[model samples]
Target: MDDRRLTDWMEGYVRAWNSNDPADIQALFTEDAVYLTEPYAEPWQGRNAIVRGWLEIKDEPGQTTFRWEPLAVEGDLHLVQGRTEYRIDPPRSYRNLWAIRLDGDGRCFEFTEWWMKEPLPE
Candidate 1:
């Protein structure tokens, strides 16, 4: 797949996330895609689990926005950095490291996100 298409697909995925629609979020992945968060947490496997995981975040309090910056692209692999803002009165921000693998047909097969957020120092 071309980098342009991959970037566009990634943008669509982020749009789905921003929409907070569980089905839209799950549409980014393949049927058996694996999504791992951190190390020990049981990785969400398959589309159903991914949809459930996203449902937990849908309709969460506060305004959330995401900004994606492409880092590197090699063949079907894409690395990107993302900034997420949880716009509470105090506002919270998260930095995310994302590795995305795209299939030959331009669909994503796996996406792993690593992120860190420190509480707004109260």
Candidate 2:
């Protein structure tokens, strides 16, 4: 996918993260989308499962902020580097890598994420 399409989809992802609305989450994926919280984990398969899985473990609205940059695009595969900072006592942060495959319609058909907690302040 092109940068513009990827940017639009990323924006939708941030919106979905902030909203946790079923429709918002559903709009980002295809009907048969696969979403993995980690590369090796079993994925949330299909739109309904994805929506249900997300809501079950969702972050509260406005609980965190995310920033990401596109790293690569080869065919339909996209890679992103990201940071997530949670708004909670003592604070928390993570470094994230995402692999996404978007459909022609710019909705993600497959997604996997890898993340590490940022080192705590000494």
Candidate 3:
């Protein structure tokens, strides 16, 4: 996988996420995709499920956005460190580490997200 292309794809993902359009987000993945969330959270498999998962959260009563900070790239994997902030009613956030793996076609195959529900500073 081309690292530069993967970076671009990641950027497009953030853009799509900010759009709050699940279809846009889902378009970034392959037909058979796997998204693994933190412990206890069910993983989303396949494009259809992934699209549904994103749609369910798009209209949530919060201003949420994700920012990806690339940590490193090794082969087809990208180690990213990022945070997601959501202002539901009161401001809150989840700081996370994302391990994203892309296939040779620059399509995302695996997305492993690990985050903690933490209080926003007063």
Q: Estimate each model's TM-score.
A: 0.84, 0.95, 0.82
Per-residue lDDT, model 3, residue 42, is: 84
Please give the clash total of every predicted structure, in order. Answer: 0, 0, 0
- Candidate 3 per-residue lDDT, tens place, 12-115, comes to 77777777576678778899999886667889999888888877766453378777677888887898887888867787788888888888888889988888
Q: Which candidate is the best by TM-score?
A: 2
Q: Quote model 1's TM-score.
A: 0.84
C-alpha lDDT of residue 36 in model 3: 88
Q: Give the root-mean-square deviation of each candidate in angstroms.
A: 2.6, 1.4, 2.7
Per residue, candidate 1 scores C-alpha lDDT tens digits across 1-122 of 34776777777787776676766776688889887867788888888888888777564633787888888889878998888888777888899998888877666778788999956876
What overall lDDT goes with each candidate model?
A: 0.79, 0.92, 0.79
**Candidate 2 ranges beyond 4 A from true positions:** none
lDDT of 2 by residue, 1-122 (tens): 35877898999999999999999999999999999997567899999999999999999998999999999998889999999999998899999999999988999999999999998788
RMSD of 1: 2.6
Per lDDT, the best of the predicted structures is 2
Worst 10 residues of 1 by lDDT: 54-63
Candidate 1, which segments miss by more than 4 Å at Cα? Answer: 59-62, 118-122
